[model samples]
Target: MNGIEHYRRAEELMEQATATRTNKSGFEVCYVTNEEQERLTRLANVHALLALSAAQADATEFKRELYRANGEELPAAQSAKERAEAKTARNAALAAAFID
Candidate 1:
């Protein structure tokens, strides 16, 4: 799912969170609906980014770490352009997840 950028999906979650969050737990619970599925996908994407940030390890090791961290392992893809795109997408997702 490397090429499957979930950035906009994440933003959609933020919007939902903003719209539906009426209490302390509302925001947290809003992430589970089918309407917020993209947000969950984007969260997984950002968590994967944390694992992918390791520079010294090979792809398999990265995959292992992500799984160990309970995140999904994105498929093996070798291309600078793709990586750049993924990074951008992940950043957008992170902003959506963290920035509100």
Candidate 2:
């Protein structure tokens, strides 16, 4: 799935985690268990990072395209696509590390 999809899934999980129900004494009780909360937190974080990475990559590409359109020289370092990909990969790796 795409980054946006991941984000949507994370949002759904967050909603699930925060869901509540009325208790016998009219007190609110969280619907999710502690383990479910932890898992949802981890997954939400990972998906959020992925979404951010995707946005960064999109912005980089847009900037590069603008530069090319303006007849400006590309950067001497890595290409926009390469840099974006590297950044996204690093973010994903970090998320994976957290899960592990």
Candidate number achieving the greatest lDDT relative to the actual structure:
2
Q: Per-residue lDDT tens digits of candidate 2, residues 1-100?
A: 6668878988987888788999999999997999999998888888888888888888888989999999997777988899999999999999999999
Superposition error at 4 for model 2 (Å): 2.7
Colliding residue pairs in candidate 2: none
lDDT by residue (34-93, candidate 1, tens digit) is 655666566756745644543334566767888878866665667999889989999999
Cα-based lDDT for every prediction: 0.60, 0.88
Query: Which runs of model 1 end up more than 4 angstroms from their true locations?
Result: 1-75
TM-scores of all predicted structures: 0.25, 0.67
Compute the lDDT of residue 21 as modeled in candidate 2: 96
